[model samples]
Target chain A: MTVTLIGGEMLHWSDRPATPALPPVGEITGRTLVAGPHPHDLIASLPAERTTVLLRGLPDAEAVAGLGVTVWAGSLDKVAATPAFDTIVALDGLDRLCSAEAETLDGWDERLAHLLTLLRPGGRLLLRVENLFGVHRLIALPEALGDSEWLVADDRDPHRPAGLAALRERLAVVREYAAYGDALLSREVLADAELSGFVSATIAGALATTGEVLADPAALATRALRHGLALELAPAWVVVTGGAADTPDAVVGAKAVAAADPPRGRTLEDELIAAAQRRDLPAMRALLTAWQKSPAAGVPAAQVIAGSASPAASDLTPLAPAGDPLVALSHFAAAAIRGDIAHLWPAPADEAELTALIAGMTGREVEPADVPPLPSRPAPGAVRELTAERDRLARELAEARAKHEFYEQQIRGRDAELKRVRQINAVLSATAPGKAVLGGLKAGRRAVRAVVKRGRA
Target chain B: MECGVHHANHYYGHSAVLARYCGLDDEAPRIQGYLQHGWNIGDGLAPDHEFVPGVPKFLWSERVRRRAWSLGRRDVYVVGAPWAYLLALEPAAPAEREGTIWYPFHGWEGQHVLGSHDNLIAEIKATEPGPVTVCLYWQEYRDKAVRATYEKAGFRVICHGYRGGWWKDLDPGFLYRQLAELRRHSRVASNRLCSAVFYGTLAGCAPAVYGDPMQLENEKSAFGGQARILREWSDMIGAEVDLETARRVAVAELGADRLLPPAELRRLFGWPAPRSTAAIELTGVLTS
Candidate 1:
């Protein structure tokens, strides 16, 4: 079986004595032809086999000794080899070509067609392309408001992906379709630093697309894009496999489900804060449900996020678990635990039922006030910004204090050294020889000043 | 198990992350498709003396299995990574669950997978009804810098280690113990699709993948080497993963045959074959 690897530099940054993770490419025993950067890895994988990897650049003679695989310094841009292989691993080769071709989708279809020509009737093309619309496009934008907040909905950068919409249109002729990407990692800007731009050169930013989000965001973004939403995002590279002849069947995990249940909560801290400011009960309730893990988790998110209650937290009480038997029981148990039964269950209920439910819930007797305290709505931008400013000041103050301490130590050392020098000079002056030398220097300085005054007169 | 350049031994951890949801053993026979060169273990490579010769062989892809054949070994089984097993495993209903757990992917230089800059501890704490538990890399459990980074963002931090200096070297199953800790949180968000993403999603937590992850392209091999070798693996990363499309796909695929059918599984694994005690210990028994 022949395995043809196609891409830019599969081994460009690969270790010399490759790590076990980068297995030797010598496993393709029959006649093989490789394209792009897997020369070293292929050499490591081979054992006296008829294997050849194409190179677009000059071959280093020292690197290509009698190691079994032949290095052909030839271009695979056209994929001109005869069709004989059973497997073709095109690892981001299309994406690389598109990049080198400067993001125009032109000539890419021809390149893909050539690749297809090289594939045998039942062979697989393990193709990888970057996502055009990923969350990075959303989050990695330059932050506004002094580079503090993410421009999540305000991205305007031109993305030049050979988009999947175009690719899917072209791939319609191919058999089998499995699309996935490698940008599973997520990105949140560190509170202090703006994110480096997505796919940009600098690595200092807190959340970078290639650095963090490991899975492709293309499928997700495609859903939104199909719905006519702008700002859909993609991953750096999406690797898909299509067959040449066989029809594509439902691979495991390829099936789609009904729309996801609404998120238990708003996970982004900023979004939750915005929802809280609007007093959007449904949003708050969902966020609260998800945030129910920590009593502590909810309060700080509430404190930092603020707004005038448009609907008011009071309006959202119906969504609360007031009707829940367990909730009722828990409330009674909480009140009982707190020894405050004057207020129970918001309204009147059967006392005996409450007691029984509480007993069942607590395994003995039951906990909380009938209604949770509504968080004090901070006056406009009171709580969060103040907290942020205070924290920033605290950090600066700590740094300043550290610097102050360091300077104080330096001053004290200098003062001690100065005193020691004075004492040494005094001791020197106290000696007869030292005093005579000092007096002579002083007299000489006085004579020089007198001579200068006489010459000026 | 999974393998990759994502971390010290990503395959080892990602495979072991299965234990985070279902109580499974490390030797339960997994294909480390997550490794970059997963399909190309050479013939001249060293044979592991520590690993017992198999009754049920675990492999990640058909290519890897073929490579094994080239090496004169044939007890090969093609099963994808652990997260794919989520479709086959029992369902976890996160809505019915309570509480949020935060998993911050810790990198080599006190970096995190999601690039989290929020003070997770304080944020979780401020949620009056919610409690947050911090998940760290096994190595990050010791790095004060990584922990301190979280603390700097507004959290009063605590590593997954002991309360103080007392529990540094203490663990019953240190190699695969994060799952037990992970079971407590109903929701989790991390920077990378590492253990937290795999286990958190399966264990019925509302999981979010966000943050800057390092060396991602190197781990692409975990997606499997052949066409459709892994199902819905594409669904689980990026914004799609953020939207829980993976979870949705997993649920739809869980119709007793979402993953390869049991007959196929049995044919491939022969999981219930009689084995010597040593073999049983080296490899784990697949439960029905």
Candidate 2:
């Protein structure tokens, strides 16, 4: 294997530092041109003789060449105009394939078309497109410009696929998988129509491992699944151009590549929230009764599968029971609040009160200890946490100011009352009847004092 | 448990009623939340009264709870009014209840009502078909001149005792006496749409709110004062209200249906459960 330099490639910069989740290496077959930078291990796994890795960075190209695969180091436009490769793998999407050193193709549509043209007749194209309206972006705080955002056309590009459905239509996709996790590290991939209880539990589990997010990604992801918009709200999408293959419906974790079993029914949390949104008290009570009576009562409702008559914890691994059963119920309660589900209470209830009410439905009264320690939860993100704190402080400040003003008014009112009472006393002393009463009161006090003195003597 | 913190919780012996409803008998527990003391157009709280942040506000109804939430209160719960709890504790005996019990809007310390009490008395005489008994706040009842005005109008005048001050002389029987007096009357009427009207409606009395709504000195319209009350509650403001509609509005405004069971109320108030029930709950917990 030789590293060929076609000039115009970046000498220092690599596309992504972390390894991205890719299609199963078993799927990358025939003479393949791996577009953009991929992990070294993934390049080594591919058939070296047939694989031709194209990288925009010289250092990345050299590293791939060391893995016993042909490496073409240059901008994507410099690659031969002839359609040669039987497969084109641009799992990083078409954005990073172009280099600033060469003719920069900023339009997503133009870059995508170029990648498609590079593929030979009867070839396959594996692509990954980041979703603009994804859950990750929805909860993301405003970020400063990064090196990768040199040409921000994704937001303005009309032809660029915006969602899973649009992407399928745009690419004529044979198979599509909803990808969840950080963009570079797609943790879980599931088929578009396979958001079953098992798939959701898997999605939630995968999302929990997300490092720093504005809000709980797990809650938002599960809500998306419950609302039947998981495919649209997925953080990213992986699409393949060609006829469908017999690949697994769900691929969990990029490295291990374990095919998850077929999906089960809806999660307990999902069903309970749906019932709550509809204000179906009887259904909610029944679901709460069933869950509380089950062996998985101590498990978080989001992690349990709501079977017909019973609930089973999705993760079979023996985990420590959430100490208070109310704590277990609070998981779904918090999710419901975060999901903006209509409150079930006839009156407005916060998360703690709602959890207590849920416990009450199961004949349990929640003590102060039973309330979930929600504030101690991993801070959603620095921005949101700070924003909430600032809002709280602002409210407290406004309250304190109001209290100060109230106290001042109270003092003023008291002063006015005292002055009014003094004026009334002055007016009373000026009257004949008032003088007689005052004289009698003075005489009575003198008589009492003399009697007390006589008794002491 | 002793009632302290924001002594208004003990106003009209409100905490005592809630405590009794929670099975505390005569012992008034320190309510874990700020119990809404009076019905107001504001967020269930007296705008002049300061609140501690994060402390729960136990309100009377869903409407007030929503209003309180809009006012930036997050930890608000609807526990119904103390008067409702009192009625639950003391079911009225069947008796020949006669006359209309009238409540004239009154002012508290540092404020005096500025309207014609004689005019209100005349309105009451004209509207009420039967005998009328006017219930006055302690301050007005203490004034012989004010008392004689209502008495001169041929209406029986009475006062429901002092509503306590600071931590001093909190009469636990305040609501009990008010409820008893209300139940003895066939109808309840008020010059303004006040808490007494709602309480009386819930206590099986036909309710009416009309005539001069006396204004307080320096009355602030911070929460859309009397105008908002008249606009929002126009159905309740008539010389003769439909009994069914009055009762329905009373139930919603007072949250009669939102009353908690004794055990749950105890938990919410952070009061200890009675030993027997505690042991039963403990057994249930361990068995489960």
Candidate 3:
């Protein structure tokens, strides 16, 4: 559901009255697989010609098949080839993943990684699951809660999806947003929704009307607009993800969060600021270089240079060599943060260039004191020599401990064997076979003695 | 999430059964918090419910409620199983039912329900009600021996033919047919809790319990009686099933009055259908 309020703090229910601008499902023309069960709104949302639905159970297969979509009744692993789909919508049932089957929550991310392998290059993977702390929890009936351990005991299982934090981490989520907005004050889901008599009718026509439409006065909508959408508060989280790739733009960093999309028209400056927050070095660099050559670059030129051009971290590789301008610029930023600015450029001659780089990386003005002298270092010959001796002794001790452990194990094994042998001998004596053998040996010894005596006689 | 429920078995029918009896959607009730499936089945089911971040709350038998409480959960309720409500509904007359039905135990590979299922079938083959109707688990349907084991014993058998385990392409018509087939039996028996025992007794049969393997075996070897809830369910396999009394007790004794209305359920559970128009922008537009 999509809703855009008119120019006011309050959504009057009729503000933006068109259908909510939700992501339509089943719209893709390429081959796609909706792997799980249906009434997965995502399935019906997709175009039937290009999609094949793989259902886990047969319960919903007839209805899904009736929709004229090619329906497969087995598992995706049992049927489909890898790198198969342009997009895969794993919306409703995730428990079918091997990790869930094995009851191994730790393997959830690994399962996701494997799923990514099924995607064509740059294929979109949308993972949707219910939030554990959905608004309904506060208003649910005790019976619906299912009087089980889950309703009474601990509630934050990674598999049951109390929230999207783990999923976000695994997917390197480019964008994560809750579909339902403002739990406490249920507002319009889309502009077309009329809050007037909303609870009596319904929010989406499926959920029972609470009869109490909450008015939050744009608190959440504003947050969403700022790209700070609160995933925890929403009823469900939808993640738009791209697989891990080497390109800086393609890579969704481990901590990257998809902010709400800003207006289609972004000033280069705004884009630069966003790139900085995302730590998108390539975007920041490209924007910075462009700005350096543009007229606007000189207006707050110093701040632009500080925010983008400077070397903030030594993380760049392949493209930048040890003394490359960009590489040198990052080193300079690091040193500047530490109040040292020597060698920010080659031989420190390019003061103007250093200032511009500093301005871009930090998004602040360049000051003379911002370029502090490098700190002096102490001599290390004697210290290095002593450290070597210490390392040699520590290594020798570790080796000795390992050898001692091996012998200790061997001795313990031998002791166990001796104890078993003693037990076996005791058992042997108790048996008739053992007794007869002993008795026979004794008789032979006595008979031999008699024979010897006879020989003597 | 994988739903965490054991699959290719009667579990797939659980939601359909509940939905059929309780006026819910054919989909499982999207209850809030976490769903443990059945509580204390904790090996595959816990540290917590594997797929959700939810507190365990039980609405089943007294035995199950106690187990959840002992696990340090104070939210225990004896509201009874929602699916058990099917028993409250009137059943077909005795004339509608045939003779006895035998539902053999099923493990992943018929492993834990017994060291070997062959022993049970062999024992039944030598017993009084030799000509019993056998209900096959989906996995067993795949195993010819499972069907053959009963068939060789000279028993009549009916098995699931679908490749997908219990609940995929389930329509109302299919459900009606499945229920009709189950109702034909006046007596039901099994080593584990199968849907036939559940729907059968509700359809007017006596369910009896004998030995509970989960109780005798270690947690690693069994899921049958491993949890407080599963134990109660498995214990019902051969007990004198008072389907009517149990149904009444569930309503009165187990606090059925507290059962939430559909509106409350919709508010509390996951959406009946996916709600976000967000997908439309990502890809294509559907005509229908």
Candidate 4:
């Protein structure tokens, strides 16, 4: 059969990237049933004679039919229950597998349990699960609901696993790779246990490489790395459960899906922040000097790894063009001041002063014009920030008005004082002895001035 | 907007100096906030003057801002002292300065000071190496007895005009006259560690704080007072204090180093932006 739709198949629409969290194509063997929209290249590489692809969207199923594979077009519940598959892939997660026209599973866990049942004994099931608390979601500005989100999945299902620990326990799989950036096209994937500052920095760079974000994701990811929560806060989880086929510790590209040596040491951004927090000036100066002298000085501090030997740029290519060394330093200085990193200067210093101070530590004098402008990104908590600013301005305005009233009251009081002083002066000038005393005082002043003037001459 | 508020903004022509520094013509704009008139231990504003709520207290120093914050005052911004701004505008060239300018502590309008003038005069004669010019406050200078005491002691006595009251005799050149007199003196001394002492220190005069800190009538010790000032500023006290240390103290107290650029100060004070030639011509054409 070319393509079969028993019931509830959506038309025209196809889930993006075709395939996400795909295990290496070489892992596909014998009879297989891929129950989701997968990449065309992946479908073509599979042993199509025995392999079967099931997709909920009619267009996606039709697109895959040309790859010489049997296709099923319908919701997951409509898939034939008779013959179990030797391999199953649902890497798009369970949420998108159902059509709005059909009665769908109530929870993620229930849907995941249903998919696992379709797998034959010893057959592998590759699944991707998104982490709600991931860095990508954490920094995202509140967006309006998309058209596809008609039935917003209530992710608060108590039966569904919440974190990595719960997810592993539910899946009963020891092999899990943390996915970064978009779940549809993960920029980088690494073994959960092997996560380090360098890996997190690379992942952070990748996540921030595209789009106008609410705030810089690189700072958040670097912070997560510092707090030892990188793996827990990974964007998505790709786990392989079942089968004896070996899995790679990391995924680099479509082909280089193999474990690489784990990177060591914290990023220069992390080290600089730490030094600044401790108020260790010498340490900060040394670190700045070494970093500025390095070949990767033009790279952003967050993208460079700070090793004991010297600073080195991480493998992740910077999305922005290489800037002046001073500008890069200025960006780090801005990050230190604006980011969650503790305030750098003991004396209150704004971004420009901090930038100049950082440059000075490296024995380079930077002009104000040379310093990069601070990026004016939309704040993550716009309403709260606006409310705070409103309250501050209100206090300032109230203070200004109060001062105005106080000045008026002062003027009134001083006017009364002036009237009193004038009345006293009038009384003094009106009396005989007062006139004599005033006349004598004037004469004395005249005599004193004459004496000084004669002496000067 | 009122160019001067609380009349103190006009005192010593502080607003005038700030306006000149802001590159504005003599017609100074009303400063957007309450400008700190004197270098006081209090929140920069005179304690007797009722502070209007929420009106910004444009303080002289960070120390004052901190103190004001602790005392439940908000919207305080430190714009340095107007005296410092004046010094920046008219810097003194190298000149043969002579004598010590001694300022006997005087009270504000609300209080009369109590102290022996002869005892201070004796102390000044002993401490100062050259001719002493006893700079008396206008109140003291007006008193025949106080004036005669210094005049008879063979010391020149002078007053730096009135620190204008109620905005009526606002001597705009008050600080200007005081700066010139301070620069003429080899040293500046006051009985108490007061504004004059700090101003002299900043004006490149050797500073001294000695003698009795003459008590004010019912002087409220709301801001630690003279005893606290002595203890806190021990580095700035004595006949021959370290000039470098004294200068540093004066700079911090006056916020001399924190003076904003002309444009920034103009912006902060809500003054008009610098007019471009084209814009000025356009305005002229419209008016004509």
lDDT (10s digit) by residue, model 2, range B184-207:
899999988999999999988899
lDDT of 4 by residue, A1-457 (tens): 4788868899877877524434462376667877776667677777888888878789888888888899888887776575777777766677777776767665788778777778887777777777887877776766789877866654487887888788878876736766664322222333333334456565665564244454556666656755666678877777777753466545544443433454545667777777766644445656776677766678777766565344322233332356678768777866675553423331123456557656655645454456777564324343433454456457557656765676677689879998999999999898999999999999999999999999999
- All candidates in order of DockQ, best leading: 4, 2, 1, 3
TM-score of predicted structure 1? 0.25
Question: Candidate 4: misplaced stretches above 4 Å?
Answer: A1-54, A63-71, A77-91, A98-127, A133-159, A168-457, B1-4, B276-288
TM-scores of chain A in all candidate models: 0.34, 0.67, 0.34, 0.69
True contacts kept of each: 0.00, 0.03, 0.00, 0.22
Instruction: Put down candidate 2 lDDT per residue, A31-105, tens digits, no spaces.
Output: 888888776767777899988888888878877787888888988878767647788887777778888776756
What is the Cα-based TM-score of model 4?
A: 0.63
Highest TM-score scorer: 4
For all predicted structures, in order, the TM-scores are: 0.25, 0.59, 0.30, 0.63
Q: Is candidate 2 or 4 superior in DockQ?
A: 4
lDDT of 3 at A266: 27
After superposition, the stretches of candidate 2 with alpha carbons farther than 4 Å from their true spots are: A1-171, A181-205, A213-233, A244-324, A330-382, A386-457, B1-4, B47-57, B65-78, B88-99, B104-159, B210-229, B257-288
lDDT of 3 by residue, A157-176 (tens): 44433566766555667655
Best by DockQ: 4
Superior candidate under lDDT, 1 versus 2? 2
**DockQ for the candidate 3 complex?**
0.00
Interface RMSD of predicted model 4: 12.2
Task: Report DockQ per prediction, comma-separated.
Answer: 0.01, 0.08, 0.00, 0.11
Tell me which of candidates 2 and 3 scores higher on lDDT. 2
lDDT of model 2, residue A429 = 90
